[model samples]
Target: MSTKIAACAGAATLAAALAAPAFAGPAYTNDTGGSFRWYGQFNPSFQSFDDGQEDFNRLTDNAASNSRIGFWLEQAYGENTLRFNFETAFGFRSSDGVNQLSTGDNVSWDRTNIRHVDFQFDTARYGRFSAGQGSMATDGITGADFSGTGLGASNAVADSAGGYAFRTSAGALSGVDIGDAFSDLDGGRLGRVRYDTPELAGFTLSTSYGTDVLKDANDRESYDIAVRWANEDAAGFALDSGIGASWTEETGKADQRDISGSFAVLHKATGLSLNLAAGERDIAGTYAYAKLGYKADLIAAGSTAFSVDYYDGSDMVTAGDSAESWGVAAVQKIDALNVETYLAYRDYSYADTSAATYQDANVILAGARWKF
Candidate 1:
């Protein structure tokens, strides 16, 4: 009888502790003063593509903005915040055959893979420190662009069906294909330890050391350092800029180093935005990209943006050859519905070093993104 009475008392105390003021709202807080909540985006898109051969329609996962679900936890201790985030994403694609939802087949969530799992500690005076599988310091800094069509303009195309073969004007298969000379060298998410200094005078510095950028078994370390700056208004224009560099040690291979930077400005008064970025890697050559975009009040509660971009890569292949790509993209942002629809057309041409021939590839892509 005494033992039963003690158990009842403990249960009541636990219930009371959960009802504390810190446990308010949808998120739940435990006795340890930590709160946890779930957050994620379900982004699905449909696309019609001209894969240089037959025109086919596909309902695909947006390559640029992948679908993900995750949860976050945080606890405040003194002047510091302790946080944790775990995120995973689906790898649904039309070419997955059995997993394509539109084929009346049972979709497989088997490939829902882990993307980020990290713990962070942040202090106002000491900045932030993070560890685990997450973004490196140099990630996304070089390819930063204010253009609304990031899903189509930059390396995001690789997430889609842009890798399909190209057909020549004569309806014959061209030797070259889209995404062959994609000049994307930004250090992506990796298992690493990273640190960032507090923003001072609109500038922040960061550095990260990782096992490998691609998580490959190279048994070498990757080091990245980056600096970023942002100003709401630089004189009369809004400015965002950053520069980053990375060195990757390759086992039994030549060590690789990459340098990249980007600058973007937007004139709010005129709705004109310009973006410029460049990246270079030793032995891999160099590439530069520029984009000009405009946002106008042509739609009610929405803005339309038209953008044109060009890429030039010198010695992208052999010593004397080069590759070039140009494209046009347009986006309509409906703020009321929180949706953005886009259309893009791109043309690629490259020097065929093996055959000493020049070939071209072209594609047209369209999609819409709804944020929830």
Candidate 2:
């Protein structure tokens, strides 16, 4: 193995060896049956990148799931309940934010790091209503995955080393980044008001309208609707799926529309799973992703999971462009320590009919996540 790979493996081993015990902190309760709790997780990774012409390595906060903290409060009123949530990231240097030209660490807290600040009310008979700076109705609709290795490999292939520029066949920078070519067209969080219907026969409906709240430069308004279903059978098979459509428009600007969905299935008896996702944008073209995974109690401490995934996208950054990526990952869960150690390898390639041919890029990531 290369020195970089060896270093990453050693770090992962050390992290697992020193894993701390799980702790959720104290949950305070009131006489009225109200409760409050705080929680968070730290996700750090060692990333090594080879962009055809050069190589770069860094220790960074995993963009797959950045370090974050949050608080939840809940109260019951007969058959109904009210809840509040506040969450934010730590604003650390991110794996995907560094590139050949900008390798220096950049870290600072900002409003953009705020993930959720919202209120929700749930009714047993009616449904659920939410208002806040949080997830839109379609958020994560295209990312459903039963694979335990999702922390390292998923539909979001760009999260691994997005900022790295692709090199042309002539060994020159193409001025285009990986993130521009490979997009999942997935929904994202925003300031919004949403409603979700009560589950009926394992299916539920949701909708939302929202706009940018933390960023001052955005003027678009967004709307979306989604449907989700989940079920488990006595035969030890489980399935989860969701589909959604969203639209965003800004005065005088061309409106954007997208449709996306994902499904995952697991066979408990065989510890085998399958995940599939697909999406299309009115202007950006389309993409599809798939992952095959297996999990088993290979160790006494916890389960070991392995997966391989692939992504293919077309016309993401510009018309006539194609992007493809593939990866393999493994994760080891330490149940007693609330920690997950992982190692992943991914390869990316892009092509454009209107531009010079580009060389492929490869990335290696090793990390650990600890939740409390």
Candidate 3:
């Protein structure tokens, strides 16, 4: 364990020394106020997991923010604007895909990897409307954080080593994996039509109806509604919050419903922040998450951020089940190089009404993200 830590530290130091600066050029604009641009980022990491009975290590793409590329086009007409967006992942081996039996599986390019292929129209007074494959109304309602450490830490606990299963006290593999017990209950993208009301006093309302269009699975109807707010006070304090509800139903299946929300506040002067989130599923589960964070200009390169978070969940996988997790992370920004390097550690524990006792699992991740 000591040797692995030392090797990771050495590799991080070498990466920092060899990092090069990269930047994106200005967008191309026409005489009629139309513009086009391309963007992307790469996030890769070295991860280690200890599942009580065994240890595992691998180099994989960060599931929090994987490598991706995108393009955007926009045109303006008076107070209204029309835009199009297209984004997709690079299909690399992911951190969450590795496990005790396999190192990892490199995903191939497919329609499911396409994040956004949508068109939107926005007006100053009437609000906005969107169509095609894109985020639903409640997409980010459960992930409000201002700590600048989201690349390494967030409300989602399963993104680190979710595939690894817990071992029983008798050194046998437990059927449950990390992902099965822990979830943020966040909304996702789909082939949908959405509408957002214009901001009024820092608050906006949104709604959407969609389905799974990228996959060939059983089709289910999904609907979502959400409200969001953001504001800054005279004392240099910033606040962001959002709440949302979603429902899904399919033939011959039980209807699934969930409500989730999150709030975050930051004091610019001190660079201290707090974030909280909670959610409940109609079927039979609840989860709450919290994080305390601090950031400072301690380095000439850019800002440095640190955070610690905890998660408590009940009845997520089955009745009488309890899941708990905690993690700490640090991120350093290199503004000149358009890069951010991070290190994070997390521990997960699970319990249930069963007679068998399950052991804990822990993971360590270190990596860098380069944006351009």
TM-score of candidate 1 versus the correct structure, residues matched by position: 0.80
Clashing residue pairs in candidate 1 are none
In model 2, which runs have C-alpha deviations exceeding 4 angstroms?
A: 1-3, 15-23, 104-106, 251-253
Using alpha carbons, what is the TM-score of model 3? 0.96
Work out the TM-score per prediction: 0.80, 0.96, 0.96
lDDT of 2 by residue, 253-360 (tens): 889999999999999898999999999999777999999999999999899999999999998888888899999999999888889999999999998886498899
Which is the better candidate, 1 or 3, if ranked by lDDT? 3
Task: Report lDDT per candidate.
Answer: 0.68, 0.90, 0.90
Which residue runs does candidate 1 get wrong by more than 4 Å? Answer: 1-34, 47-57, 94-112, 155-162, 166-177, 213-220, 356-358
Q: Tens digit of lDDT per residue, candidate 1, span 1-372?
A: 244234433432332233222221257788877899875553444444453455545555555766667788999898899999998775555321211123432244542256788899999899999998888899988666766667557633334444555455566655444444555667778789999999999999999998753344558778999999999877788889999999988679879899988888888888888888888888776888888988787979588888888878766545655767788777767676555666666666666445445436555555555554
Which residue window of length 10 is worst by lDDT in model 2?
A: 14-23
Q: What does the lDDT come to for candidate 1?
A: 0.68
Q: What does candidate 3's lDDT look like per residue over 132-223, in tens digits?
A: 99999999999999898897789899999988898999999989999889999999999999999999999999999999999897688899
Native-referenced Cα lDDT, model 2: 0.90
Give the backbone clash total of model 3: 0
